[model samples]
Target chain A: MLEAIILTVITAATPLLLAATGELVVEKSGVLNLGVEGMMVMGAVAGFAVTVSTGSPLLGIVGGAVAGVLTSLIFAFVTLTLVANQVASGLALTLFGLGLSGLMGESFVGQPGIKLQSLDIPGLTTLPFVGKILFGQDILVYLSFAAVFGVAWFLNRTRAGLILRAVGDNHASAHALGYSVIGVRYVAVMFGGAMAGLGGAYLSVAYTPLWVENMTAGRGWIALALVVFASWMPWRAAIGAYLFGAVTVLQFHAQALGIGFPSQFLAMLPYLATVIVLVAISGNRRATLFNTPSSLGKSFVPDR
Target chain B: MMRLELVKRAEKSRLMSVLSPVFAVALTVVFAGIVFAAQGHNPLSGIWYFFLEPVTSLWGVEQLITKATPLIIIALGLSVCYLSNNWNIGAEGQLTIGAIVGSIPPILFPDFVNPLVLPLMLLMAMAGGALFALIPAKLKTSFGTNEILTSLMLVYCSNLFLDWMVRGPWRSPQGYNFPITIDFHEWAVLNAVDVGGIYLNLSAPIALVLVVILAVVMRSTLKGFEIRVLGQSPRAGSFAGFSNRRMTAFAFALSGALAGLAGMMVVMSEIGKLQPVISPGYGFTAIIVAFLGRLNPVGILIAGLVIASSYLGGEAIQTSLQMSSKLATVIQGVLLFFVLAADTLILYKVRLVTGREGEGARA
Candidate 1:
């Protein structure tokens, strides 16, 4: 029972970890893409549709990532090139993604989905709790951990990452230093989009193994909050995602246990927890300012 | 590969500012046509059903007005919030809470059948919305929380609360197991005015009055100037003695009140009773309305009608073309993207540069 619960929590946390990690990079690059939810939903629908058509969950995941990249490019063009308000453009991207995905997935509703299978090593498959907990998970679960460590390394140890961070911190300075601010931001935004897509694909192909309109159901927004709770650190985001996943799983368990409270109220736990967590994290003015990218969410236009 | 570059203008272009929305609508229509064609339908017929057929009949026009009323009211309040630089994205929650609070007089005190019940309900709803909105405002002022996330989070909480209410304590005895409340008494309902054989709800005129009042306030009041100054530059606003904290609270409360009023109107005029769900995403849709209207009261009113028609058109296509009503949401989203993109033309000139010449110049 304990191992089963842990596995469920990991499954739940993987998507959040995936998305929050991507958003952390985007914010570190000084671009706030509010459309994580949009890209995510698009990925979910596209991933599900492709999986259904191709009978391969692997291709579906890739299709979802590509869909996210394509969606993020629209945002890139509007904000990075046209220099539109990043906040509004992000909101537009979200609304567009939600609507477009719903329309696209209209036919896929109520269809039985093919779940992504878990990995099985020859000898490790029959091992007790620890082995199953660590080695018996699906491919995306492993990828999520790899992504966190990869992002942590990329942000701290890489020269290109330093350039990306520099652009986010002070675009004008980075521009004067001969780095392409818009180019770096575009890559960051697209990366964020791809990660969000992967997260969404996991929802449709692994977590629930079904296509539902707005299946993301505010997870994208929660991922956004996770970035803040982590103070923009990749590893911290992983911890935050797992904590939220625990809360979510515990709530479901409580509902199953018939604790007598209304299920609706129980359902409110994650969202309420998010608000409380945000207050606690952002309440520290010095800490928040210490880590937040100076140029985050501000539009950049390079002058020749 | 060709790349797009923007060069800032010395001053905002008046012509482009006025024409941006028009250009956005045109662009959305064209893209919508392509979407329809891609789905194995005639693009022209899809356009006709999606945009034109909804407003051709008197009944259709009534439905348009009915839908536009709440959107206009909600957008008007949002304009104030946006203009003051307060991002109140949780108007949907405010609306839900407003509907609940407004329904109290009717559901709890069904025996109270005086004209005063309606007015009192409206006031209670506005107060409910304002107070609910102040949650994020207070958090921002005290804890310095990000209002956007807090506000949005509250939406889910409020929605769940509403669902709990209808399914539990507030469920009507006579609702036949449906998750709904009892029918509201006549005094609690908003009546329609018959204007020469055409019936229009009282909420329509109320929305219009609000638009006019807000237009005047935004145009001439010192408060309006304060909102504008703060939004443009918080430094200048502080230097000029306008309090950012107070402005945040004020903007949120005002928008919340308006959203509450719209919610009350929706319950009183349309639904006529409380239910598990009261709105069809009107609060969020109003955000699109607020932007498409350029954050102006009169412009919002017009934009509200345009969007409301889309809702009708979505239904029309659902029946005529067998398309999902979600197509309306797609069109609205596309329209917003174009609006944001086109507004760029107001302040900058976009030029397409071919080849490495532009890249070399930048380097």
Candidate 2:
């Protein structure tokens, strides 16, 4: 039972970790992409449809990524070139993605989805308790951890990272220093979109292995909150995702254990935690300053 | 030939206001047709179902009003919030609380036929929604917290609470173990009448009246002027001695109240009972309606009806064409994008250079 619970946490946290890490990068570049949910849904539908048709998980991943980036491009156009409000455009993107995916994936409902195979290491598989819990997981789960460290190194140690940060902190200053602020933002936003798509792929190919409309079930929003909870740090995002994963996994765990509570209350537990975390992190002056990306949702329009 | 620029010193252009929406609708219809064709469907048939089917039938018209009522009510409140440059994304949560609260009176006093009961429910729903809105409002005022996140996050919790109550404490004993509540009595329902044997709910007229009243208030009232000033220029508003904190609270509370009333009307008029899904995304969709209406109450009234027609048409298409009901949602979303894009072009000219574009670039 303990083994199953541990396995569930790791599995559940994978999608959030991927999505939040990508968002962390996007926010660091000073662009708030509210289209994460939309991108994820697109990814979910595209991934599911590709997997069912081709019977190959590889195509599924590519399809999901393409769908995610395609969806994100709408946001990129409106916010980047048109200089529309990021928050409003993001909301619109989400609305568009949700509706589009629901229409596109309507036929794929209830069909079996492609299952991502777990790693089979000989020596690690022979290990008593740890093998099944750690080594036996799918490739995506392990990639999620590597992604955490990779993003950390990318943000803290790379020259490209510095430029991105500079663009985010002050577009005017960056432009004055001969950087194409709009160009950098477009790339960052697209990268974020691609990553969100991969997260959706993980859901369809690995997690549930089935198609369901709106299956992300507000996980995209939770991933958004996880970025806030993580204080915009990559390693912290991993921890926060795991924590939320536990919160999500434990609901089912408690139900399995005959823990007496209305299922609705249990379902609401993670959202309540989100509120608590937002309050706790927001109330303090230093915490808010450190966690919030300075130019998170503000639009940048160079004066003509 | 280059077009001549017309210089006019005017606050607003009547032609621009009238033409923009028509242009937007036309553009949206064209864009949506392309999308439908891409999916292997006939664009003409798509337009017929999306635009024509809902308006042609009596039942379709009723459904259109039923759909428009909630949207207009919620959008009316949201205009105030948006006008103040405050984004209350949790109207969904506020609406849920409103429905839950409003349903309480009807559930507890099943046989209560007093007119006061309905009024109290409306009051409580408004109060409940307002109280929910107050959390984000106070948080922002006192701590500078983002109302968008706080209010939005609250929605998930509120929905869960609603789900818990109906499925657990409030579940009807004789409901055959379904996760639902008792059916509301006739007294709790929104009263409607038949004129020449055509049935219509009271909410239609109420919504229309509210739109007129709000339009007048927005154009003529001191508070309305303050909201506009705050939205256009916060510094100027503060300089004028208008309390930003008070305005924030007022915007959110007023928005919440209308959302609450919307929720009450939904339960009383349409469902007549509490269900697991009390709303069909009315609160969130109203955000679209509010913007599409350009934040004008009268514009919102028309926009609400138009959007509601799309919903009916979407349902019809879903049944007849065997397409997803979500097709309507896609059309609505595309409509928003095209409309907003059109609005931009209408309000601001897009310049194109015929020659030597690089000559103008000095940076």
Worst 10 residues of 1 chain A by lDDT: A119-128
Q: lDDT per residue, candidate 1, A107-179, as tens digits?
A: 9999999999998666886788878877888888888989999999999999998999999999999999999
For this target, which candidate reaches the highest lDDT against the unseen true structure?
1
Name the docking class for model 2.
acceptable
Q: State the lDDT of candidate 2 residue by residue for B217-327, as single tens digits.
A: 999999889999998899999999998899999999999988988988888888787777889889888988988898899889989988888788788777766667787
- Please, what is the whole-model Cα lDDT of each candidate in the order they appear? 0.93, 0.82
Clashing pairs in 1: none
Q: In model 2, which runs have C-alpha deviations exceeding 4 angstroms?
A: A1-4, A120-135, B1-18, B352-360
Model 2: residue B348 alpha-carbon error in angstroms = 3.5
How do the residues B1-363 of candidate 1 rate in per-residue lDDT, one tens digit apiece? 888888999999999999999999999999989989998999999999999998888888888999999999999999999888899999999999988998899899999999999899999999999999999999998999999899999999999999998889989999999999989999999888887655798899999999999999989999889999999999999999999999999999999999999999999988899887899999999999999999999999999999999999999999999999999999999999999999999999988897697878765
| Deviation in Å, model 1, residue A148 alpha carbon | 0.5
